[model samples]
Target: MSRVFDAMMEGLRGNLLRMGGRAEAILDKALRALWERDARLAQEVADDDVEIDRLEVAIDEGVLKALALQAPVAEDLREVLAVKMIATDLERVGDLARNIAKSAARSAANPPIPFPAALTSLARSSQRVLRRSLDAFSRTDAELARAVLAEDDAIDRAQDEVVESMLRALERQPTAASQEVDMIMVAKHLERVGDHATNIAEDVILVAEARNIKHAAKLARNR
Candidate 1:
């Protein structure tokens, strides 16, 4: 590869990593806002999502241009595809974080209730998974990526518990139904965050070994 092309690829990687960090930050802020019932912080998280969206579009455009100009093949093609997938996942993570922030803002504007314990646990786990997956991608560590995949099940279980708790809360205190509903949405958003993180981890596998683990088994016996 030419120096310019190499620099372009490196720039893309750096931007993607920055995007991941921003997404994580947004999620963390949203969670803090939810915990503290801080409407301003929630709105800040939502507003910050615009930058992540811009980064996603710029990364995709760069990838398309590089593909056309460089005509990457074999491992290079896999890397390009993986970066595209990782960017998409990070963008979605940002969207989900925005959603949580919106929910938190709504809740903050309303009653004086607290966030659910189960949901809070789930959100923290989901955030950890998101960061862990990004760490795996930065290090190109497939084993750590696989560990992130394993964390998704715990999030799912926590989500189910949160849903049941919200439903019961709705039954007992119909007046605070909106708050209960917010809890449900937050749980769902966090669950989806975990899902997106898992997706990024799968993409990391592809980037590390040019193996598509989503379709094949343990990246085609490379486990």
Candidate 2:
């Protein structure tokens, strides 16, 4: 029975990792479609979102089953619960990536607007943070999770600058207003991606250390 329980746990972990990898790919492809202005690729991303959604459902179901059957204690319980939370966060990332793809499709319909350089840079930063956050979760490294938390403010600042720049450009060129607004939406989506990744990192800390550090993340970063 113990061996059976352990095997189930391993299967659950593999499912979680696969979901994470696919979610990350969705974000990457969405960003690519946005940058390339490929409506076809954007639509593909929207379609792929269903798979990520399915994975989230499976993860939730697995956790519930584990709870009902194994009645795990301490570390086992923490891992099962934390996986559900991580799946939720990853699902949000998928949703945001779909939004980016939708925005990209809309922007592609209009004549090209002046690109916001800062926004692209911020997108890259968010992707890096997300990758690191997932890595931290896989490795159960709280310090790496802290590094992910430390990068949140940078994402916030970049989003602010991008929005301001887009607003100014819209004011000067009313004709490109629609596309400029789409740009802002894209930037905002990417910002939310960073937030979700940060949340995942926080969940990892809780799962590994059995401590609530979400509220204290900012204070730690300040130190």
What are the TM-scores, per candidate, against the unseen true structure?
0.93, 0.94
What would the per-residue lDDT of candidate 1 be over residues 1-223, giving only the tens digit for each residue?
6776788788888989999999999999998998899999999997899999999998999899889999888777777788899999899999898899998898888886655688879988998999999999888899999999889889999999999998988989999988889889999999999999999999988888777778465566876
**Residue 124 Cα positional deviation in candidate 1, in Å, after optimal superposition:** 0.9
> Candidate 2 — what's its lDDT?
0.88
Minimum summed lDDT over a 10-residue window in model 2 is located at 211-220
Candidates' lDDT values, in order?
0.89, 0.88
lDDT of 2 by residue, 21-57 (tens): 9888999999888888899999999899999999888
TM-score of 2: 0.94
Residue 108, model 1, lDDT: 88
Candidate 2 colliding pairs, count: 0
